[model samples]
Target: MSDDHENQYHYTPTLWIGILFLVLFSISGILHILEALYTRLWFLLPTVVLANIGEIIGWSGRVWSSQNVFANTPFLIQICSTIIAPTPLLAANFVILGEVIRRLGQKYSRLSAKAYTFVFLACDIIALIVQAAGGGVASSADTDGKDPSSGGHIMLGGIVFQLVAISVYMLLATEFVLRYLKDRPVRPALVAAVGPRTLDTRMRLMLFGLGLSTLAIFIRSIYRVVELADGWDGRVISTERYFDWLDGGMITLATFTVNIFHPGLLLGRGNRWFGKHIDASGTSSRSGTFAEDATVVEPKRDNGPGAKV
Candidate 1:
């Protein structure tokens, strides 16, 4: 380690915090993979797994940083990883909310269920690209022993855009829920998935988990904005404690919450699109795994008005 190496960080990245996030994300990731396979939610694996992978790599960088605080390589790794880690997770959230709107009633939603995923994911990708560019610039600046404020500003702007997108999504979700409550217009097909009224309880529980995860992500975004607002040397950015609590803590909470109450755990088997079979009774199969070569047959729609739970 050269003594003249530019120190990119204000403080040594905490060893315990890095280990904690790494362990937590690993656990969450493994559990989610098992749940997804059991529930046959292959489509969700890319985004959800990517988020966990990013967190793992990012935290590993921090652990390395603790060993060599002045290392630019690890600094770059952590910067890029932390900034972009949540984007894929946010994509997963968008898809979950989309499914919620679909099951509840598309009439109550401002946009069609599929449209929400398409639109939000596109925007999420754009934000990710901008943040990636910013990270590159910041890393280059740090290596040059120059001001990284421009890169910081770029990253901050990208994060702010993300926050705005999340805010809009929250508003639309609230509107959809409110409209559903007022109109009482749930899809008739959602009547009975297994027992008489298990569908409603399961859907509501999944929605609750989605909501909590989104809120945690929103809060984490705000923390990042504040941390970067003052540039590379900002007080908030300097504080390891703030990073642990606001940054790592929030992501850990969101990941675990979403996984514990995963839609796959509840709604996956019921949705034919999730890669499982649905029966005429609108009930999910007792057990099954999705195979790449297997084809899914959509169950016939039961149009009859069944009583809601």
Candidate 2:
């Protein structure tokens, strides 16, 4: 490579993108707190927080790399975190899909919601492991030059698997939605029992938010795969500014948007929606026993004080 080309290829992390992701992750923490309170699902909160942390780390590493292109530590850290950030988001999506399936009735839906959840999460876990291992291989190598070696193969295969998983998830989700809509009668069983009504605007909005977020995340993953496809020689790494907006900023916005308009957050006040209950402390409880906890049941007949009791 020419000296001028080498100089141009010198490493520098994008500070602006790093700061943006930091702020985004910070806000994600706030949502995590709210989600914990609203859903009372303590386990979920940490996952969300962890995902945000990964994003923060990834962006911070990018910023460091911008200043010191030769810094291997930050590069390794960023690569690992970037690969893992979406895992938490996938977890969140799983919960949402599960809730939808349950509401639509287990018997009516052909595919098991729980099964889908398991499969999606399992794929994510596998992808994470592969990517993590690949990151290790890349870091331990003597030089950063692209080698069609085992490490590159691992990274490439892991990314390809991630892309496939994301695609399958989208396809399944679309199928579920289409089936749900088509099967839904003008008077659905639950609606008929409760009262006739169109789709609730609030619920619809939550669904839309989830769909949008999922699409954004899928898009971001594809970009990463392309960016890393040719190893370091790829134009994606050199065109740092484009990726800053395309991957970092867009992903941050998507993550925050989904959390803010999550089904539990938007519909929590209603005891009947999304299998949640708002406790006095402002936390949402994921207890399906909301009817038992909140409902006031009256006797069917008083019988005039038991009539000669």
TM-score of each: 0.82, 0.75
Tens-digit lDDT track of model 2 for 1-309: 112124233446657757767787878877777776776555456566677878888878777776776655666677667876777776677666666655654433444555656677788778878877877776666245434245656776777898798888777777666644544432245322322223356657777887887888788878777877756666775777757776776677677777777666654533534555567997867643322222121112123444542
| lDDT (10s digit) by residue, model 1, range 1-309 | 123364567788878878988999999989878878888777568878788899999999999999998777887798789888988899989988876765555655667666777789898988998998898887788677677678878888899999999999999998888756555333434343332112366767887889899998999999999888866767888888888888888888998987888877766543554333568997765332211112232223333478342
Who wins the TM-score comparison?
1
Q: How well does model 1 score by local distance difference test? A: 0.77
Candidate 1, run of 10 with poorest lDDT? 288-297
Return model 1's CA RMSD, one decimal.
Answer: 6.8
| lDDT, candidate 1, at 155 | 88
Q: Total clashing residue pairs per candidate?
A: 0, 10
Candidate 1 segments whose C-alpha is farther than 4 A from its true place: 1-6, 184-199, 274-309
